[model samples]
Target: MDKLTSMNVFVRVAKAGSFAGGARDLDISRAMATKHIMHLEGVLGTRLFNRTTRSLSLTDVGASYLERCQQVLLEVEEMEAAVTHLQTEPRGVLRISAPPVIGSTHIAHAVSEFLKIHSDLTIEMIIQSSPGDLIDEGIDVAIFLGALDDTSMFARKLASSSLVVCGSPDYFEQYGIPETPEDLENHSCLVNWAIAPRNKWLFKGEAGYTGINVSGRMQANVADPIRIAAISGLGLVMLPTYIVGRDIEKGRLKVVLEDYTSPPLDVHAVYPHRKYLSAKVRSFMDFLQEWLEHRVSVIPPVME
Candidate 1:
């Protein structure tokens, strides 16, 4: 029997809760289903399902293996689709959405480079203020920042992005550098306009996690404006390190709060299966996964 066929039979048995039920569903006899599962168990040397007279259940190992089995199946499907997509010479518009900072800096660069190679591709890049339902909007691909807790989507983590607390030299000169989380209150705090719980800036403190209530006269819904304001020495900004990293290095902005950086956020490229992935989305995701993992290094040296 084919390995995939046996695994498929085993998956059905585990899911349906009985060999008899699995056979009925797969249109095979119970004896064949038993043999198929027996072969799979013998090969792996683990009992996947525990059977009793009244009910069927999976053992601890069986439970864990089932999830892995499902993931393996999805990967196999994706691999086949990828081959098909590549062979088809993927020509079409690739619509991409991401947060403004990432889209403008990293993703946009990758897209431009990708177009150089696959010249037929065109992209509609939307720098979103917030994320939305991909399934609802017909969005081909969504480039997302931060750890994804959305179980509804399949997330491929591209990289870990760090945070930076920075202000203009003038702002820090006037207000002073904050060596600790407590010092943030003494200085003006600039914030992103769209962040939920907008008034709070998170920090990792010596004791544990802490959130500081911030008050600043200037705030904006996007990165460019906030960055412009910060560079002009208006107020302090706590941003993902990538956004201000170049400015900080160029001496346009000064980094502060070395001991109090937030935990890294995982950047991800996500999409709806959309039945099957088009060549455009698949190709770009492959590109982004590489770029974010290797190309972008936004972690600033621990502030001196």
Candidate 2:
């Protein structure tokens, strides 16, 4: 068996977390997948996976090796593309990572359109909260919202969405609208840990920028749940306009503190720094930047 082919199989199996799952992805028999693993173990003289009938997991060394294999395969793919003169046109698979809300909505739509233009390109999108280890997971690009914390990766600004503090009309009627950022203290303010400044909401007022350390009976890591809670009249929520735009438009939620403005959440496309950039990644990045800019260019302070 080719060493490179064995490495690819091993990576598939490791990611799938089961030989059957990996074999299914590769369109190979379980026996063939097992053979590939055994072949690699024999060459490396190390046990890559600890297997039981119920589960399969990578060993410490296997975890490290998986990262190396992904990098190697990526380089080989780039080299082949260059040799075939496909460097100018994207071909093969392009893996992406993105936050769930935007990933399923805007980013996914952009990818579908890009694929239409480049029929030879394939895209695999992983909707995840964090970017994770890009190199280890073999992700070509990651769509990030808000500020960039990791300075190691290269990033490009794609677009921005305004943030809004809102709640159900019933809740506002019952609790009374918060007239100022500081007035949030008197009301229940639902918090989403996923967005930056998490428990603290920021706003720009006559006194300049201020951050309010907010707390509520409800809190979540994702924006959707928080949005749902606000719609049900549980509490107020601070979320990006993209997540709560429709709700505001439909009157399921009402925007508050219109006099104050919050910083727009910046959307970014991030990827690991690589010396050789593949046409698939480079072209998609350029396309997505332009696509998102037009789509999310102007997020009104209130969807209405």
Top-lDDT candidate index: 2
Kindly list the per-residue Cα lDDT of model 2 for residues 1-304, writing each as its tens digit: 9999999999999999999999999999999999999999999999999988898999999999999999999999999867666667799999999998888888888888898999998899999999989999999899988899999999988889888899999998888999899999888999999877878999997787789999999998888888899999999999888788788878999999988899888999899976668789889999998877766655432222
> Residue 214: error of model 2 in Å?
0.7
Q: Please provide, for model 1 over 250-293, each residue's C-alpha lDDT reduced to its tens digit, 9 standing for 90 to 100.
A: 89888787767676767788887745667777777887788676
What CA RMSD would you report for each candidate?
A: 14.6, 17.6
Off by over 4 Å in 1: 1-89, 147-150, 194-197, 299-304
Candidate 1, residue 35: lDDT: 91
